[model samples]
Target: MDFSFGPEDERFRAQARAWLAAHLVGPYAGLKGRGGPGSEHEGAEDRRGWERELGADGWIGLGWDRAHGGYGNRGATLTQQVVWAEEYARAQAPGRVGHIGENLLAPTLLAYGSPAQRDRFLPPIARGEELWCQGYSEPEAGSDLAGIRTAATLDAGDSGYRITGQKIWTSLAHEADWCFVLARTEAGSRRHHGLSFLLVPMDQPGRIEVRPIRQLSGTSEFNEVFFDGAAARAEHVVGGAGGGWQVAMGLLALERGVSTLVQQIGFASELGEVVRVALRTGAADEPTVRDRLVRQWAELQSMRWNALRTLGAQSGTGGQGRPGGADPGAASVAKLLWGGWHQRLGELAMQVRGAPAAVGPYDWSADRPYELDALQRLFLFTRADTIYGGSDEIQRTIIAERVLGLPKGARPST
Candidate 1:
């Protein structure tokens, strides 16, 4: 129903808009249109400044508890979070330095971590002081996360475990000071039940190495990580041993929710850019281009509203990780729709630009100089949207088994 924000919510939205207007100057005005603040070395101060700026304003962790350097959940409505995501998209602020930390790890810590763990990790993450990365997707384990081979052996003295393994596709590993990783704690035990989650420091002397991966767009953002004889203190473990499957599932729920909402909002700005470019180049008048743009706008609006409904329902009823709960399956639907739409929009953009879209990568400043690099990169990257964060096939399976009560599929013997 009523999609409109009530009086108090509207007031909060107005306040946020005003604050963002004053503090955020050029380039940061549109969330999706703007990119990350330079590379690791170049962005250090800007990243810190943005983090501290948001942290000081109490906007860094929208759902975090107040006692831990956050504004605290404070009965914060999901609508508020959605508004923040959408508005921040409009604001074009630099993306989070520790996305894995803030979105996945922080939530898990709050839900299942010890009080000490919470105190140790949450504040710096909120303040942007300590960046974190994820060590989940290994060379052997990407979509089949249950198939991870990284192991942690318990110490003989009843102390911490020794970790040695390699992780690939680790986004931001080189810049991260910390990582939330999954390791097989039990030998000869297979499946998801034998795993454990560890909070690891990246700056340690031995047992770890970080090598950045260059993307097709020439960005060294993701990395390959190796850990040898690394020690993880017992207290760093979240949940119990053998309970990592459950924790991983919960973390996936967090990932799906955050990605579906924040990312869709972010993608909307790109669509807007497409429209602006078309209008600037006189291509907006073409019948087919006009129809596609209109279709995209409609699809985006529909998807965003559906996401809002899911958020409101989850917030009011509290069924994020419960069986027969609202279920995180809503995220799958969002991802499928948004991912497909993004891919299509990129195609349409290229078509509209025609030969001009093939030009060499020029700086975005020159008039009529189409930044084909950005368009090409998006077109290329959006091809993987349905594959990463659980593939489209996986999402359909989730809907079939969990949401539709389909019979479980049998697995092959290894």
Candidate 2:
């Protein structure tokens, strides 16, 4: 596949950059999160507001059709989206607040959800009116997802099931209006067979409880959700009964393929921020820090290439499943490489900051909060990069068996 963006893509980039220059101004110009550079900065509302603006302008769902509340620009190819990712990477756009909606749920709905389901969910999500969070990782089922104990039994006579189970490590549940969950409906089937995907409301219910989980950065980035006989709609069912595995796999494809792109770009931007700090503080003069920064930059580029390849595949340009497409092995490789890159970058950033990296928020000037807080938070979060998206060991095993065509190991005893 052609890696270079032709004249068409270059024009798209120009238009996007120009529009961003005009609209992303004043308070909304800065990055999100703790220790950001500016005191007058954008908040979640600002991010949502910008999303609404993108939606209104048809820039929000850059890849989706116009009828589905997107900008309906068919001119932009998957390459153009990659270009958009690049430009946004340069501008330091907010790392998607409704990632579940935009990346995982939206695409899944487009592919699997009914027209009514699409009509109800897509527009609100595109408009930033409804936020979504994933409800996949349960207490007993992280990597071994088929072991999910969450039950969504059919009710006597109704629109939905009586869902009762606990989902842990649910990201952004605090702000989400809906959750795409995986629950078991069949009792006799093996790990991957008896599951179904459910779209659940967070507020209404049998009993909805959300408890925030603190990260190493001392921030509550994820939550634990407890559901007790939550009423869901039959329409919310993504795939047929005992098909949750397929639906969940598709969602994971979105997770590892599309959603991962947004995050990897965001992380790459953070790596760039490290360079900016190095330049600002004269840390680049240090050979160690300079070499580390250079390596991180190279890794970021490699990841971008991989992401482009995935997008190209999605656009039907290449192999059956792009590297990081639906294949678990491919996703595992992407996750492993991405996690390593992020962790190394964080370490390098802290090293560049030296003693100041450990200093609390109070030690830094308010103007430099972006660097300070990012360094702190990134340092904390990077530790889990290997664990959250599936452990590094699992990734290696996938690569060995699937990618390398190695002999399969004996199945682990449950």
Candidate 3:
């Protein structure tokens, strides 16, 4: 359990910091601290450009190995990857539009995808030429993901699959170049069985439609994507055709990798802001506010250590399966820890402002709609923290059955 970073890691950190300082300038200079969590709608075009800047500098896939028919990723160690995440967060770099590809999709491909799939997809993601979105959650399947009803039929004519289904709460689907979708490929198959993970192109004019879902936060980062006979090349299938359940599960585990560390760092920044606000507004004089702030800081520190302890274990296997950590349920544990912690921080952000928190700074121009301030948006968005990303209930069930060896919960008839 060594938590310390050596001089080499520090050198990598310095390199990352210097690169960010050099590039986050002029047009991009105003983008610092703009896009994150609830604020994904802000500076999106600028952030996409920033993604290209990151890719050009070899910062996109630090952990991807060039040895496995991969492209020129930095091949950096897990510690160095964490160093990069930390530096990126501390610099308040734009919330990465490419994170789904660079962190989740890339790793999943290395572990399960064919070499051809890797060659086709990895390079664009590394170059930031393409962006991706996950098509896992459907209207009926969200937390009970095995219940997905989306179906993909193989088309013998064009030698591809014709997929027809709807995906809801799809983050950034409106702007994505492609979508990795989980759909039923076997007619009689039920639940997680007979499912295929299909790579769907988003540009099909008549077949695919992206409708933005407005949130209480007044942002439409989430979307509902309809695939009415959307086309997917048969070659684009990863982990082969009936193997999507495994691939999708593995990607879920990877969701808790270095990005968790990055997210925790962002949580720290949010907490700091709340503390400063409390002090400025004299809310710190209240014993309850002071206690809550101190507790949040302590919990955040604990989360950092847990993430570091699990980083090596997860990295060994590309964060797939029950990644080898002190606790086999570390991924679930991490999700539970942060999801609730972040939601609380958002509540605190609003609480510190008292009456002013209810109101917000808005641009009520004749052309644009009203907007919520950062803290107001934070409160609104975190309301869904426990519900999205597999949900708190789902995380707990994973721990109960997988980690604690409890009897499986009942499932409705498929």
Candidate 3 accuracy as TM-score? 0.96
Q: Which candidate achieves the best lDDT against the true structure?
A: 3
Query: Model 2, range 1-414, lDDT digits (tens) per residue?
Result: 788889989999998888777777776676433222111123756776666766666565566645443423343567677777677766766656666787778777766777788878887876767888898888878876767888888877756787889999887787788998898876665678788888889987448899987666656667899998887887788876777877777667667654566667677667778888889888999897788888888888888778766666565622122223444465676788888988887788888787888876543556553433657767777888778867787779878987889998876443
Give the TM-score of each candidate: 0.88, 0.87, 0.96
Clashes of 2: 8
Q: After superposition, which runs of candidate 2 have C-alpha atoms over 4 Å from their true positions?
A: 26-42, 65-75, 279-283, 317-328, 361-372, 407-414
Q: Measure candidate 3: CA RMSD.
A: 1.9
* Clash tally, candidates in order: 5, 8, 0
Superposition error at 65 for model 2 (Å):
5.1
lDDT of each: 0.72, 0.72, 0.88
Q: Comparing 2 and 3 by lDDT, which wins? A: 3
Measured by TM-score, the strongest candidate is 3
